[model samples]
Target: MSSSPAALSGGTVANPRSRVILASLIGTTIEFYDFYVYATAAVLVFPHLFFPPGNDATALLASFAVFGAAMVARPLGAIFFGHLGDKRGRKVTLVGALLTMGIATFLIGALPTYHQVGWLAPALLMLMRLAQGFALGGEWSGAALVATENAPAGKRAVYGTFPQLGAPLGFILANGLFLIIAAILPSDDPSRPSQAFLDWGWRIPFLFSIVMVAVGLWVRLNLVESTAFEKTVKAGKVHSLPLVSVFRTHTRQLVLGTFYMLATYVLFYLMTTFSLSYGRAAVNGALPGLGYDYTTFVLMMIIGVVFFGIFTMLSGPWADRWGRRGTLIGVTLAIIAFGLLWVPMLAGGTIGVMAWLILGFSLMGMTFGPMGALLPELFPANVRYTGSGISYNVSSILGAAVAPFIAIALWSWGGGSPFWVGLYLSAMAGLTLIALLMGTETRDVDIEA
Candidate 1:
């Protein structure tokens, strides 16, 4: 006699692998949106609202320092969450991280300004920002590993790119929201307008994430466990201590993977922070050069994000065909070459600004697109989450946390020559290139048990 339909369906559960990818993509996008919303606010609003003291330059620097503090906390988060994820399950760890980020972001939005609470306001903001950074440390690695591991044998790169796309996509929305808010306010009274922004306008973005978190939770709930991980567990190959396992067995992959991300990480900071500062400096000057205002500069970034998405979409198929190592190596060289154009175009003004943003973001997309697949693929299935998370986050210490400060110091100390900055970017790319060359290609690594 034929088995019942329910019995047959239960015999082989539907993959629901697509659900896993969708969940990772949506959840990551929301988490990053929350994190970067604060980043954009740190540059635009926090200096005046929270640190309204001393000279404008000093206040701005102080605000950036607080922003850097968040980055400093990220490695800690990586270690903490990385341990939890490796020991517990990926879903629960990610859920806790998301909740922390969402709540912190919401609290930031609702924070009392310095005017209302004296020193207490900024202190609270700093604390919340620290939480934000810590949460992000775990979020990226978990989502990337989930998406890639659930993907079909040959399509890991393509599936993995969806999670990476969240960064630029979130950036677009975060900055885009702020841009709209900034546009609506009347510019007739400059100080009053900015004061009004500090009081309430800046908080709107942070508050929006509360809604985002609810949505992310709903989507995440439906996700099934990763098939690769499931296989490892069933085979009794799951590591008791994933972090220790990675350090002991996959030391080379850990070191190389982190170093390999150096260029892209620094490039990410420059695109967001330094570029905004440069645009502001130009607009305040009385020159007919490419002195576009913040709105214009951000709009240019929006255009570039489109290309970022395209290049990311292209990476999946390209990596699957050319191999991940080749794609990563070629892109690193391209970034190095792009650095050569910095002095010429940045000195040229508006057109130059557009050129630089376009070129930099294009290279960013290519390199970042393949990394999600490449990094995890480097590790054996037993410790994939812990190995990839540690390498990815520890790399942040060298590559991202100090990149903007280093860039600014270079500009200040070089007597106005951005050549130092260009060299800095090039040096990072060169480091990553060496790491990639020395690493293994995991395109054909076994995924199924």
Candidate 2:
């Protein structure tokens, strides 16, 4: 772990390329898995078990409210963990964040239901959700920096995608397990959850996170500090407080980076969270829905996530070849266009719905992949952790934290049509497009410099 000014001047890495990929990818995979596990349960189980047994809409909104509360805590987390990351180092900060998330998620499984503890159930739920958000706030940027900083020349974006790949992989694993559990405790009706699942089956995913967290810790513990970080240390450039430095000096980049991710966040939450509600709603509502079963809809989303994985991998090369800004601009434009297809595609039946899922997930992959490189590349190594973590998590509040709530309100107002939701997506993408246009290409930038 010793780094001299001379060794770091030449940028000597303690970790090889393979180690870089594994460390970055494994940490994020476990982190995102912990996240998606809660996300799936929030929709499928929380409303029924944790909230007061009354209005379904009220309960669901309550669940989402707690869910979005985490977004508020994320920036705080970014400040705390980002400080540790920029000053102490990425490896230790990442390990700490992962452990925090794992512990919170595991404890969530054992919490008492509303029937058992009344308001305390939801209160405790929000507390744990906030912990998850805080941990995730620092996790993504640290993982991204680890990958990109350790990358070989011209391959930063390629390596960046390794960490971004965790989103889809985690989604698949989390939901795939839920699917298996649902099978084990089959509901009498496709439309409703089995009593067994509501009572106990839902806890398994949350409780299982500790095992994955252990493996992530092992991989990350073996990682040495990256060359870029070493160089920064050798140069004595680590800031006293990266959060203050980033805000004071990097305001423009911070604003641009935050908005740049808006469309991706909006599109993502809509596709997964809102779609689950829309897909499984009654066919005879005021505007009418597709009337899918819970399992059927989740399965559809999982199928589409496969495309998300494939395209996520593909976007790496595209970003490397064409450059991160230019590539994101192209995909952001496509997202704007994709927003218009929600109504028809969703209404067209299973095939059309599948088409919508595939297309949405594909655009999601393309846009999200480059962000791993693009955000950290927005700033120098000195404040990279704070700057990137803040911008990224701040976007979560603007886009993801509110997207589902807004979309649901819009859906009801539109009489169940997804048209307004599509417009909302397009508008967010429009802002992202403007942001991308202002951003410079970072593909050839020397991140360690």
Number of the top candidate by TM-score?
2
Model 1 lowest lDDT segment of ten: 1-10
Error of 1 at 274 (Å): 1.4
Q: Report every candidate's CA lDDT.
A: 0.78, 0.90
Residue-wise C-alpha lDDT for candidate 1, range 210-240, written one tens digit per residue:
9989988877765556556666777788777
Each candidate's clash count: 1, 0
After best superposition, candidate 1 residue 220: deviation in angstroms?
Answer: 0.6
List the candidates' TM-scores in order.
Answer: 0.92, 0.97
Superpose all Cα atoms of candidate 1 onto the true structure and report the RMSD in Å to 1 decimal: 3.6
For each candidate, C-alpha RMSD in Å? 3.6, 2.6
| Cα error, candidate 1, residue 73 (Å) | 2.3
